[model samples]
Target: MRSLIRQGADVNAGDVGGFTPLHDAAREGHTEIVKLLLDAGADPNAVATEAGDQTPLLDAIGSGSIETVKVLLARGADVRGNDDAGWLPIHEAASRGTPEMVVALLEAGADVNARDAGNETPLHHAVARGTSQAGSVQIVRLLLDAGAELNAVDYQNRTPLHAAVATIDPSAELMRLLLQAGANPEAVDRHGHTVQDLARMNDNKMAPAMLTRALATARRDTGRSR
Candidate 1:
């Protein structure tokens, strides 16, 4: 690989997924291969046509490959690029609950509040997944600490709180966290339903009540934090 790169092989060549060699290495979690590609001038921000317009950094984030994420970011990867999937690297990281990737991207100058074509921020995606399998809560907390807007709405006017109830296990603790962080449950979506209303209809009993509490807390916090 080093020899090929030195011989002028395209370091940024893509395969069927629009994945560059860097993307491939990152997807495979090959830190050494990634280092080799980067040292050879592979464009960290290069998007392959086969990879659905996703950059190496975004691919790494989707796979939750923190080591590869670090390598790409260190090489000046654009963490904010929205691919055909309508997801930024931070969004992918948050969706997968890759807290390390989330923190790293933010620290590397990725916009925590950056919205995709759908106007969904990292925080919006983070709180949407109610499952405990990935680090959803951790991702949400990290976004909050990084000054993510708890009340930021998507194209549908759904807040992060609106998303938290859609996942499995319906993280009550995460709902509490977003509430404490000032998410507005009373804010209605494009469908004219509040986050609390969505939760109530979701078949998950715990999350709706928690969302209601969050709405109340948001009101209280607004009164007191002033």
Candidate 2:
């Protein structure tokens, strides 16, 4: 690789897919190659056509290479750069439930509440793609603690709580977390369906029951506080 560079190889050359050497190195977790490519003046923010305009940093996050991500960030890669789909690196991290990547991106000033093309936040992805109930719960907690909007709505006017309850594998506990974080149980979607309505529509028995109880508790608390 060094010899090729010494011979004046175009470090930023892309194939038909628009994948630069840096994108390949970052996606493959080749830390040394990534450094060499960046040192050779490869554009760190180069987007791959086949990957929906994903940058090297986004690829590194997708590959779950923390060290490679560090390398890209050190080279001044755009942490907030999004793909053509409007999915940011933070959104990918959240979708994969990689807390380490999430923390790293956040530390580098990634917006926890950034919306995708669909207007869905990282919290929405975290809940929608979470592999398990406990995993989703942890990721949700992380986002909320980092100041994610508890009631942020997507293009469909569905909040994270709404998305959570409507997921193929719904978790009552996840809904509980959102409610506790001040998510509005009464909030409706574009179709006028509330969180409970979504849960029932999705055949999620536990979530609706949990949301109802939480809503009752929240109402009582509000009444008392007033």
In the order shown, what is each candidate's alpha-carbon RMSD? 2.8, 2.9
Which residues of candidate 1, in runs, are more than 4 Å off? 3-8, 212-226
- Report the C-alpha lDDT of model 1 over 7-79, residue by residue, as the tens digit: 8899877667667788888877888999999988888888776657877887777666688889888888887
> What's the TM-score of every candidate structure?
0.86, 0.87
Clashing pairs in 2: none
Per-model clash counts, in order, read 5, 0
Candidate 2 lDDT, tens digit per residue, 1-226? 9999999999999988899998889888898999999989999999887758979998898777888888888889897799998999889888873777788888889999999999999999887863473355677778899999988899999998888878877765666677767788788999999877887787645666766775676666667777
